[model samples]
Every structure is written in C-alpha cells, then in structure tokens.
Target: MSAGLLATSPGGDVLVAAIVVPVIGILLLWLVRPRAVEWVALAALLANLGVAVAVLRTVSSSAAPVAYLIGGWQPPLGLALRADGIAAVFMAMAATVLVPVAIYARGAFGAPGERRPMVFWTMLLAITAALNLIFCGQDLFNLYVALELLTFAAVPLVSLDGSRETLKAALRYLVFALAGSVLYLLGVAIIYGAYGTLDLIGLASIRGPDGALLLAIGVMTAGLAAKTALFPLHLWLPPAHAGAPPAASAVLSALVVKGSFFIALRLWFDLLPPERAVAGSTLLGVFGAAAVIIGSAMALRQARLKLLVAYSTVAQLGYLFLVFPLGLGSGAAPFESTAWTAGALQLMAHAFAKAAMFMAAGLVYEAIGHDRIAEFRGLGRIAPLTVLTMTLASISLMGLPPSGGFSAKWLMLTAAFGEGAWWWVLVIAAGGLLAAGYVFRILVPAFTPPEEPIARVKPVVVRREAAALALAVIAILIGFLPLAPWPLLAIGRIAAGAP
Candidate 1:
C-alpha cells in the first residue's frame, strides 16, 4: 500500500469514542447496582453501534483511512487509531454478534444483580471494547494491550459457572495464553530493539527481510497462531468454549478468536514486505490445510454436540490461513486481490454462523439437559426454533448457496484456479465436504422421533431463540454481497502510490 494514502482525517474523534465508550461502562459498572449493568451495557453497545456505523459511513464516503494521531503527534512519538474499510466492517460484525448475545444472555443468565450475570455483562462489553481496539489499533504495542484485555476478559467468561471442571478449563486456557503472551512479548522486544519504534505504519516504512525481522515475525506468528487456535495449538479452545455459557461461547467462537487472527493479518498483509511474507504465508497455509483435514475428522469423532461445534471452529479458523497462500500465488497485491476479499467474507460469514450455532447448541443443552448426539433424536420436534436456527447456521458453515460461506468459498475457488493452484482447490473442496459430513452428523439424528415425549430441561425463552436466529440470518444475508472481487474492501486500502 502506498504511504501517501493514509493520514489523519476528519471524524477522528469517533475512533476515540469507539474505544472509550465501553471502557467508561467497565469503570461505571462498579458504581451501579448489578441489575443496572445489563441495561447500561446494552445501551452502550447500541450507542457504540451507532458510532461504528458513522465511522463506516465516513470511511466509505471519503474512500480513505479515517485516522487519528494521538495527542497531535505522529508515529515514533505518539499512538494512532485508524479505521479502514476492513476495520469498519469488523466493527459492525462485533456489534451485530454482541448486541444479540447480550439480549440472549438476559434470559440465559437469569436475574441481572447476581454475581455471575453482572460479571458476564461487564466482560461482554469489555470484549466489545477490546475487539474494536484490536481492529482499529495502529500501534503494535497498543494493540498488544488491547489483545491482553480481550484475553483476560475472555478467560473469566470461560469459567463463569464456577464449576470445578470449568475452573480447570479456565486454568488451562490461562496457562496456554500466558505462554503465548511470553512469545509475543519476546517478539515485540526484538522488533523494538531492531527498529526503535513499534508503530505498524512506521515499521512498514522501513521493513526488510533481515534476519532480526524474520526472527521477530516467526516468534510472533507462533504466539498468535496459538491464541487463534489454528491447529495443534487448539487444545484449550474446545474445553473453554464448550464449557462456557451459551452467550459467552458465542462471543468466544464468533469474535474473540478473530481478534488475534486480525492482528496476524495486519502483520503479514499490512506490515510485512512482500518478499518476506511469501515463505511465512505458505507455511501458514500448510498449517491451515492440516487443520482443516485433521480438525474435521476430530469433529466427526465427537459424541457431544458442543464439542463438535468447538472442533469445527478448529477447522473453520484454518480456512483463514489459506488466504496467505492464495493471496501470494498470482503476484497480485494481496490487499486488493480476490483472495483477500474472499478471506474477509469467510471471516464475517463464520462469525455469524458460528455464533448462532454455539447459541443454538446452548439452547439444545437447555432443552435436552445433555448434548450427547445419540440422545438428540426428536430435538427438532421438541425445540423446532432452536433446531431451525442450527440448520440455517449449518447451511452457512457447509458453504451452501445463498449463504456467505458459499460466496467465500466460491471466490476462493476462483482465485485458486486463476492462480493455477489446483492443490488448494482440492483442500477447499475436501474441507467443505468434511464440513458437510459433520453438520449432517448432528442434523440427521435430530430429525429422528424420540422414543417418548422429550422432557424440557428448562423454560424456553422466545427472545433467546430469536437472538440466535438473527445471527444465523445475518450469515445468510452476507451471501447477498456481490459474488466477485469486492471494491468495497478496497475503499480505504492502500495498494499503490495514488494509483
């Protein structure tokens, strides 16, 4: 991307507000009665959505980055916040998934004043704030802080129920995260020592494929891959996500994992020079392909419903890594390429579909008191709404027509073939077929009639059901985006020196 394309612009304060609004709520939560937290958090998220939309409108209209130089100082001296078209899109994604999860949680967690409910609400809003910063942050160190905030907030929600088992899962999650943090910090130290500044744009200005720089990239990528759970490093995710309450699980699967993945994107596509990126990108794609094949098989082996969804996440996240290789194949600038747009659509589609699926799984747990797939017979009849939600969400995951997943896969397939990357095409097709197999594993048995009237494990909340369904609908609706290389994705992307 051209250095001339990015600069501080009007509506910069909106970028500040996008991060500060939820931090204000986090602070005020202690002063308010616990019951008021939900109302306050919900209102804040709604307001944040409005601000995010305005930022999106501003960037779209200007066709450039909306940037803020913190304290009137530029990089190497002060921090920055910037929203490109991609950032705006992700901010919108966070709001869409989060507000609905908030609504669903009101019923899932019961009375608001309770400690668990209060904690969950505060953390949920905190996650919204942290993820926003992750998307918009321009300083590497500043982004690290936001990532830690996301990690800490997310860890608590994993063990929200306070079960001994959940506590253990949370502990395991924390330990792995802390280990990843150490590696990430080490990489940060290396970069700072080598370059004397940690701003992304600054690094981009001076980046080269030196040994020091490559070492930093290697260590940092390892750390991030751990957090994003791209493959073998995913040991902690299934337990943590599966154990959390439904709403929390939705946020974790849908948005939290994407936070680290987003930073990885920044590193490879935005910060790293092309010559340096190719080898690393291909390595990531290899890991991704491995994840899709192995993770899907693991998912098929799961007997429980939520575990299947969790392992499927392991597979779905792998698809994102394939972008690195696909983007590199055609000598096309990655930021402006079909592969880039395809990957971004995949990210958004999975967010909506996975959130809905996790929530629906939670409801299934609520309806059946057990997530064992064997006992799931007749659930479609007993909780038609939840089952319907799962089915629709699955359609997106399976990459079927009239859904965003299909659109993403279709574009990626085109890119693969255009680049003559037939190997990747096979991986994509195999991954989709495996995805269908796992999805059917759940849905087919769900169509069976139970031996007797299914017992309701808990009271059914119509609003809760609706919230999950809304996310599923959003996934389907994203398929409506034009099925071609998207110029919208390039609205604020810097690719050439003023073309």
Candidate 2:
C-alpha cells in the first residue's frame, strides 16, 4: 500500500456514517411499526444527506482524500473506505436525488403494513447504503460486494407492482446483472492472483503493462459496461426502468446504474497505466458514440413517456464514456482534463434532469390515466405544473443554454476540438440534435390543443410537483457554474496535471 494510504483523516468517520446510516434505517424499518416506516426512511435519508454534505465539505476544504481504515488495519490485510473529490460529488448527488424521491414515493408506498411499501422502503435504504459504499470503497473486492448489494436492492423495485410483465422484466434484469457480476468477479480473482492485493491505491503504485493486468481490466470493463447499461449491452434497462413505479423509476434511472459506472471510471482512470489503455478507450468511445445515435433515435420512436426517458438514459450514458478518449487520449492526466469535468457535470445534470422527467411522466400518467404521447393533448391545460416540470427537464435534456446539459456538452465539444477529434465533435453535435427531436416529440403534442375537453383522472399533488421541479431547477442552476476544468475534481487524484 502507498504510505499515505495508512493515515486515517479527521472526518473519515462521516464516510462510515454515510454507509451505516442507511443500513441502520433498513433495520429500523423492520423493527418499527409499519405506520412509521415512511418517517423512518425519510429521517435516515436526511441524515445520510448530512453525511454526504460533511464529506464534501471535508474533502473540498482539505483538498485531499479522506481515508477510513477498517478495524485500523491497512490494505492487503484489511479494508478501507475513502472519499475523494469525485466520490464526494457523487455521494451528494445521490443523496440530493434520494430525498425528493422519498417524498414523491409517499403516495405509492406510504400505506402502512403493506407488502409493497415494506419492500420499497427496505430496498430504498439498501440502495442508499450500497451506493454510499460504491462511492467510498477503496478495495476492488469490497466494491464487488457493494455492486451486488445494489443489484439485489434494485431488482425488487422493478417488480414491486407484481405484474407478470414486471416480474419478467425483473428476472431479465437479474440475469444480466448476474452475468456481469460473474465477469467482474473473475477479473477480481485475476487481479488478486497476479498482484496479491485488491487495494486500488496499492495496485496503482506498482501497475505496469503486464498481460494479466491488462486482460483483467478488459474483462472488468466489459462487466461494468453491462451493469451500467451502456449500448449493445443495454437490453435489460428500458423494460426494467419503464416498468417500475414512478419513484422506483426515478431512483433506478437517476442513481443505480451510476454505481457500476463509477467502478468503471476507477478502473480506467485510477488503476490502469494510462498508456496501456488508449486503444481500449477508443473502443469504448465507439460504443458510446453508437449508444448516443441509436438510443436517441429509438427514444424518438417510443410511444410511451417512461420508456422514452429510459432510452434517453442509454444515449446520455454514451456521453460519459467519451470522457475516456477525450481525457485519457489527450496526454494529460485524465482527472485534470476538460472532458473529465464535463463527464462529471453530465452525470450530475442527467441525474437531476432524468429524475424530474420520470416524475413528470408519472404525474402525467396519474392525471390522464395513461402516458401515451399521442394522447397527451391539452396536458398543459390540465396539469400545467407537471407539463412545466417536463419543459424544464427537457431544456436540460436538449442541451439548451443556461442548463447543465448545455454546459457539459459545450465543454466536451471544446475538448474534442482541442484534441482535433472531430469525429467526437460530430457525435456530440448529432446527439444534441437528436435529443431535441425526442424531447420535442413529447412536449409539442402535450402543448397542442385537444380536439375535446380532457378531464384529469386524478389530481396531482403540489408538493410532489415541487419536489420534481426542484430537481429540474437544480439541473438548470448547475449550468451557471463557471465553464472550466474544476480543481476540486482533481484533488486526491493520482494524475493531477495540466490539460
């Protein structure tokens, strides 16, 4: 292990709490009366949010990685939980999305002593703990365990309604997830056998262009890509995400897949020798490019609003892998590059925007009793707040100015231009145009006048509308941040360099 890896930082306990609080909440859910389940889940989520904020503040203020050695033992002998700037950002982002989702979920899963409610709340807290662990875990094997927990927690949410179709979708998701898990575990075994350690920092210190290490990284990348639902490996996402309840859809789309993607990011940017990964990075970029075009085109053709948003996820995820070629291939440190910051911003912006979009779709369904895009005439007149929420989210999704999506894509375009990778520039431009096409497909019809009067099947709650709108507004507000590579993102990274 690196010498610095031994020292535990002052606020490291916050990272522990970030993971532990949610687990405690899960336990309390079973112990407490069913009447208090919602309150218990909400309180735990709020406390976890506090821990996320504390870790963010501590990492930013100190400008270093905060490490918590398990049982006071160093790596190769024990485990460690560490949060760097990027981890802190991701943790806070997950918590930010979760709090509102818990609020929005109250309608569906708030009923006391119900089986679905019990399952939903338990899985919600499990997801929270799993995500916290994914963000902070330093050992590769430990992350595998975290990833498995995340998959198990998420699978139940997909089948919460207990419909035959939903059960099938859930099973399909499980199969894909298990396949990915096997590949990932095999890679971990390879790494451990070759290096005698699974600690990422220690592995980085002695990493070289060895065949075993390269092959292991390759296998691991493929596994994580499947779990992340990246293009060509994304057969399970649309059905699973679109079939779930509205709140579940938001959590799955906004947060779950990101856990696997973060592990992939660590593998490519943190563990591998930079020079050895360029060819593979370009290959991943190819997959990303295909995902952008194909996924958006598919989304444009979708008749259902929820499925459309889910396909949009596949496209948006494509933009993330572009960071590999744009940042890693630039000869600068990946953490310091414009593409890196752009990728991070894109992740944050998409999480907030997509969550809002899913919530709006759910509200539209609630009001009209269906989510068919063709029948959404006069949506603006009936549920104006919900339509407005969709509009705000669409702004971000289409990469319009003064929105987070715009900022991220703009930075990516700038980086591609600097690298003279005009193919990526074209990909980015086409993606924006295609995104506009799908987003408009939903909005234009909704705003159009109906042939006859349309009555809402149910009244939409003002607070739920506000919860979703708050997330959309945050997505827009993120655009106002300075359009530059952030120093905070590079803090505690191994490759801090001028891009």
Candidate 3:
C-alpha cells in the first residue's frame, strides 16, 4: 500500500462505524430482554445518524473519497471500505428516513412484550446494516454478501403480520430474489475467472468489452433489474410492499430496492466500458418507460390505499432507469455529470417522500380501521394532520414547484433536451400528469363530506404524525437546493487507473 493511502483518518473510521454500530445494536437487542430492544434500536439509529453526519462533514471538507482497508490489509488480499460523495449522500438519506420510521414504528409495532415488535426492530437493524454494507463495500464478492443480507432482512418484513396473503407474497418475493441471486453469482464467477479479482477498484482497471465481460454484465444487470422490480420483472413488488407493515413497506419500497439499483449503476457506468453499455442501457430504459406507464395505470385502478402506494413505487422506479440514455448520450457533453446527479437526487428525494407517504398512510389506516380508498371519504375531517402530510408528499410526487420532485424532473428534462431525446422528456411530463391524477383520486375522496360522520376507530399520536410530516417537509425543502450538478457525486469517478 502507498504511504498516502495508509494515512488513516477519523473519517475512515466513521465509515466502518456507520455499518458496524447497527449490527452491534442488533446483537445487544438479541442478548438483552425484549423490553429494552426498541429503546436500544432507537439509540443505535440516533448514534448511527451522528456518525453519518460526521462522515459527510469529513468527506465534504476533504473533498476526497474516504477509504478504509479492513484490518490493515490492502485490496485483493482483504476487504476494503470506501465512501465517496455519492455514498455519503445516500448514507445520510438512509439515516434521515430511518430515524422517523423508528419513531413511528414504536407505536405501530407496540410494546416489546409481543414477538412481532422484537422481530420488526431486529429486521430493521439488519436492513440498516445491509444497506450500509452495500454503499461502502469495495469488493464485488463482499457486495454480494450484503445483497443477500438485505434480501433476508427484507423478506421477513413482508410476512410479519402472519397472514395468508402476506405469506404468499413473501414466498413469491423469496423465489424471484433467489433466482436473481443465482444469475448475479454466475456473473461474479465469470468476472472472477476473467479478471482474477472481485474488487471493484481492481476490476475497473482490467475489465473490457469482451464476450465474457459483456455476458457477466448482462447477467448481473438482469438479476438486479428483477430485484429492483423494473417493469415486467416487477410482479412480486406490489403484493410484497403492500402486505408489509407501513414502516416496513416504507423501508422496502424507498430504500431496499434501491440497493440493487445502485449496484447496477456501478456495474454499467463504473465497471463496463462505455461503448458496450449502449444496448443494455437502451433495453433497461425501455423497460423503465413501460413501468412508468403500466405501474401508474395499475395504481389508478387499485382499491386500497397501501396497494395504490405500492403500485406507485413500481411507476417511480422506472424514472431511475431513464438516466442511462439521457445521461450517457451518443456523444459526451459537459452536462453528462449533471444528468448523473439529477438521477441520484431523484432517488434521494423519492426515498424521503415515499417513506413519509407510506407512514402517513399507515397512520390513516390505524385511525380508520381499514385502508379502503373509497371509504376514506372524510379522512381529512378526522385526522387532518396526517392528511396534510400526505398532501405535501403527493405534491412532491406530482413534481409540483418548490419540491424535490420538481428539481429532479427539471434536471432530467434538461438532460433530455441537451441529448435530443425528446421521448424521455415526454415520459417525464406524462408521468407527472399521471401522478397528479392518481394523487387527486385519493385526495378528492378524502376531502369529500361523508353522508354520515365517519367514526374514528382509534386516536392517532401527535408524535407519529409529526415524524411523518417532518420527512415530507424535508422532501419539499430539498427543492430549494441549487439546480446544478453536485460535486460530491463526482468525487470518486471510476477512472481507468484508480485500482
């Protein structure tokens, strides 16, 4: 290892802590009595948030990728951990979404005496650990482990209610996810055989556009697309996401699927040569556009509130894939980097807004005893605060002005115009319109006066409503950020000679 690389700093240590601390908390919860688990989980999440903020400060000040070679061993011999601008941003986003979910779940999951609450907290921690690992992992094999951990952690959450329908959904998700793992593993094996190393930085230097490499990229991407629930491959997503508890649904839809998508982005842009990416990128984008149309249509037809939100997730994921064609055009331009950041910002904004929406939806269901959309005719009259939060979140989803969704759409539109890809621009506009329609479908009914005064089944806690509202407000506030490419996302570009 070079002397420059070995100069360890506090920033690097915090990167390790962001992942390790949550796992430690999970261990403590298992070891301790059930009564203490929720408090322990909340404390760990708060501490993890502090560490994430520290990491952001360190990276922003240094303006360099923070690297930590585990156990003092260098790459190829031992695992390495790294956080560049993108990783830090995502880590912070995850922490921000998680804290509120933790708070909301305290009421939804109930006291630690029940087995369900304990299991929910434990799985939440495991999911947190898995996501941190995915973001920070520098080795391909290590990332595979993290991906599997994420799957196992997330699958249980879908069936946490122990209902037959939820159980069926969990099984379907498990089967498809396992198949994805197989394909991804096969790609990893090919890469290992061809390049003799699975480290991302190491392979970036040696990988090329050969048949083996292309095949590996194709198989791996196909696998990840399934996990990401892109288009025709998204059959399992609606049921799984809608069946899970609201907190779990928020985490699953907002962040869990994103983990695989992040890996696919790294594989295409960082690992593969530019020329080889054209066909695959177009194919992915086609599916994405289809998802936007199909998922939104399905969402409009859904009867239940949570199901509608789940289908909306399917539609939203499609926009992420559109980045491939718009960002990396036939010829490069100065705005390419801007497009990349726009896509990332979209992911971040969606995470916050969707999580808030789902949590708010959950609170509504709790108050009304059911989630039937038609039956919620007077929801605003009963739980005005929760309804207000949902309205704010829907504005972001509909890409209204002064919201994060608007900022993301603006950048994506700019990229489309710059690249002469008018189709994507049309897609973005149509998606916004469709989003507005579906959001209004729900809100219109909620605002209408009921023939008879709707009786509230239960009273909602202010703190839970406040937590959901705070997240929605953050999503709206992100729009105020300057509409330019973020430098942090460009800090650790996968150059030809980095490894």
Clashes of each: 1, 0, 0
Over 4 Å off in model 2, which ranges? 1-4, 495-499
Q: Could you tell me every candidate's TM-score relative to the true structure?
A: 0.97, 0.98, 0.97
lDDT for each residue of candidate 3 in 398-491, tens digit (9 for 90 to 100): 8898989899989989888877889988888999889898889889988998889998999999999999999899989989988988877777
Clashing pairs in 3: none
- Model 1 reaches what TM-score against the true structure? 0.97
lDDT of 1 by residue, 1-499 (tens): 5552245688888999999988887877777887677788888888888888888889888887789887888777888888888998888888878888888887467676787887888898889899999989988889888889999999999999999988998999888887877788888999999999888777777777688888987898899999999888989999998999989999999999999999888777776667677788888999999998888999999999988999999999999999999986669777678899999999999999999999999889888899999888898888899999999999999999999999999999999999998988999999999999999999998988888878888867889999999999999999998998776676655333322
| lDDT score of residue 432 within candidate 2 | 96
lDDT (C-alpha) at residue 314 in model 1:
92
Clash pairs, candidate 2, are none
lDDT of each: 0.87, 0.92, 0.87
lDDT of 2: 0.92
Task: Estimate the lDDT of model 1.
Answer: 0.87
